[model samples]
Target: MDAVLSRLKGLTADELREEIIKANLKCGPITATTRAIFERKLARTLVENAGLTEPDSSGGNSAWLDSSGSVVPPCATSATQDSVTGEDGDFGYGMGLNPPEEEALSGTVCPCNVENSQSETQTPSKTAQGSPTFFYGVCPLWEDVLARNERAHVYTDKKEALQAVKMMKGARFKAFSNREDAEKFAKGIFFSVKFPKLDHPSMMEADTINREKANSFKSPRTQDLTAKLRKAVEKGDEMSFTELVWSNPRYLIGSGDNPTVVQEGCRYNVMHVAAKENQPGIVQILLDTLENPDFMRLMYPDDQESMLQKRIRYIVDLYLNTPDKAGFETPLHFACKFGCPEVVNILCSHPDIDKNCKNKYNQKPSEVICERMKEKGQFQEVKQKINEYLEDRLYIPLLRATDNSSQPVIGAPWSPEPMENLSPRLPRSPKDPVMAVRAFAGPLSPSKADEFRRVWKTPPRERADHFHNILKSDPDRGAERVGRDLAHELGHPWAEYWDFLDSFVDLQSSEGLKVLEEYLSKKDFRDRAHEEAGENETSNRFKTPSPVRLYDCLQKRGIFFSS
Candidate 1:
């Protein structure tokens, strides 16, 4: 018993596990036992099996004790013989003896002898066939290894063999075309194993060439899952949607070319699909699932937020407010445009919802609802609900006193310069108030604002005339159109501000003209506006801010601002 224990201790963890499996010993699942545990279990199984066997001719206690007084386990002889013959070896083929016989013969053998004998016996047959078969073998052991199987594996195809080795839990693999090489590898004598040159060179060369390009292609399983998810979302099948998304949270997080939720052409995520289909339940489920701690960890495993609840909140907010690629519209935008008021209300209730988010057209959810109401002659109630929600949540005081305080000026006072002298020459403005406002207001400097105020010093009726001319020349003939153009020109920093001005002040009315003039005349407003614009400028000469930068800035600001 002591000698048998000593022999078991000399074997590696993998060898111990292989012996245990051959002995048909139940050590629970393969993943449950550690190396020390495997040694103990195999040692106990061997002692018990030896007791059941009859004594040898020398009248030793059992067949385990030989005449030389050395311990030889019952199964060791047959295992050693199989290693040499290369027959009935367990190379993940399950070709070994049945459990009852296997238990009676289970024992440990040196890996080098096992590998060399098998290779010696098998190599001749392989060579005679001239098929150039490359035998790939792997034995998975312990939780550290990543193999799919708990036993050894042998493959003829190099690619299949390499893949199996990678999937092994222990991450250990050996591939060799030479018998001596295989023996060295099995004994852990070498770090690298080399394969023989095959007739078809492209098989090895193609993997290296296409490795990078292959990264951009989604796996077939992921593609299939995405297809099924889309179908469930489109059909408003909440049960199927939850089952698919919840079971595979990693897919929902999206990475590289495998966006779990989005469609191929339009790039609309599942949120957009649900909202467009008026699936309020699906939207609610998505929100709830995103808040799951386990799911959030998968989405943001390295989140800087240490608190689990806070990290989940951050992830949920991102998914809730994320916009689609095609229209730059959030799910809320789609809800207002195509879904019911219930869907809009549900979205609005989210703590981090961006009610003032704008799409590529610079239209907000309320504005989108209004357009839908006009075009389809429906969603009037939805529009009213969204407007009411915005008024309550995003209300900006209309009666706040405007400060006339002055700010310190930098550089020389503004002076008219030739368009050619400007680094990025300003957009040429035609001789019209509306086009001039569109072009000049974008590059509004403190000096330019003062010039506009001076020009507008005429009587209220005259100011009304200028405003009326702007209205007449406007192609859309809408106050909102002028506001949108100005907002688009100003870019994202003050888009919501311009929208606010357009919504509250009726540019078509004379009274609204008085309010606009008063607001523009404020010294503080001009200074702050110029300062903000200057901060965004890269050069002294004015140029339109980039749309991409504008979008990034707006996203950073969470797409909401107070006027």
Candidate 2:
């Protein structure tokens, strides 16, 4: 009976799915619409493999029991304690809701399907006086000793075991109120491995922790079978998988409904299992075997799809769109959760899939990808793929301007020097002294300022000689207002550059002095100008001039910096 219970507990979803698929196929071809009905039937056929079988509908013993032959009531067991004073308070064993007809070392009765079988009924035997009897934790005790496991030396009376342990080890130990709790701590002394199975509903409330370890426990046979199937999938043992599936077609639909809490907690289908496991080859085989090529071809009118693409689209629609036990999450969600870019790419390519499908959490699979990227460093590649998919869905590129012109894609604010749009363009020789000075200095070149230095440092006679020589070769041809005339000849954008130059040439003019002072004092002007010029590569060409460089140029012509 223990062996049977172990087997039932060990079944895995993958093994079940394979069995169902094979069982269904054994009958004949079934349409997608009829598949659900067939699958339910398939689940019943494979129940034995899942360790669940119909228990006796008539009450005698529950459908299943261990070899020890102990009968357990359907109601949950509770523990009770009767504390007795000695050197330490020794609590008596708990009593069960029903009186004992027979005693067994270990026993369990599980719910199962109806099957006819009967065991010899045992006559009630009276327990010895002061002997503990098994009882629920909350029930009142009849005698002091409620129950005992000879192997573990556990007594219902907590003080009895506590005194024994204290005397032997010379160390104080906690007193347990029930046989199970007493046995758990004292079992180590007897080198016992078995732990009591007390599945009282109230136990769940006491500690809500879900036992993942309990879920994983399985019988040896089930373990071996599960291993064989998984190994076949891992090794891409197509022959083995095919044979296994053909033999057990019912395993295909076995997992969908009334899912085994152990396997289908995530509500994964066969295909979802394959996708999450990253077994694309196995995935291909499952799709190829499960799908009807003729029906698939009819779904697409153009028939342009290659066999591979056709298979992928079919697989995605068949499996990727289906959510697992977790509501609204598809195979794509599982693939994304695993951070598999290869699987994601394949799923995204399928035309029928909703890349933007939201799960119960109102989150898209791409959003899940973003979250997973933070946990796993390798998922960055997966994140990139998801981002590309999102961009493909959410972003639309603007059309380029069709008109072919020499104009820039994004033109500057104004035309080069068409003050044609502004107030009549101040006369080339304005009446304002500042304007006249700006005009005369025309486009000062920081690089050329050294040439004017010789004139400034020279004697009066030499200065006159240098000035005339300058006039002969200078582009201004020694105009009366050399600065403005030279500036105008240099060009339009240089108006400001030349204006700075005028401050040095016409140093006697109050306006020129003011311009020079302003230029020197406003260091941030150049920074602001550069900022306005912009940092973007497309607009950097419009950057403002460097004030430091311009100041050096002025100082070269004997115009030293001042406040």
**Which candidate ranks first by TM-score, i.e. highest?**
1
User: After best superposition, candidate 2 residue 294: deviation in angstroms?
Assistant: 8.7
| lDDT values for all models | 0.49, 0.42
Off by over 4 Å in 2: 1-239, 253-262, 292-318, 373-375, 389-563
Q: List the residue pairs that clash in candidate 1.
A: 75-105, 145-169, 145-170, 146-167, 146-168, 146-169, 146-170, 147-167, 147-168, 147-169
Instruction: For residues 1-563, write the lDDT of model 2, one tens digit per residue.
Output: 23332333344545534645675635434555654444556555444344432221112222333233222233222232111111011112222112222232112232232321122223122211112333112211112133232244444333444444443322223444455764455434332333323455766644554321222222223343355555566566778877765554433323221111113356555556666676666766665655644433333333444753654454546565777666667867767776766566556544456777888998888778745434576666767765554332110011112231211111112221232221124464433222112112211122322222222223257346655565455322132223322333333111222443433334434555676667667744433434544466434323444666566645543345456
Candidate 1 residue lDDT tens string, 306-404? 565875665566666778888899988888886466677667756678888999999888777745433455555556655554442221111111231
Where is model 1 poorest over a 10-residue stretch in terms of lDDT?
A: 393-402
- For model 2, the run of ten residues with the poorest summed lDDT: 81-90
Each candidate structure's TM-score, on Cα atoms with residue i matched to residue i, is: 0.30, 0.25
Q: What is candidate 1's local distance difference test score?
A: 0.49
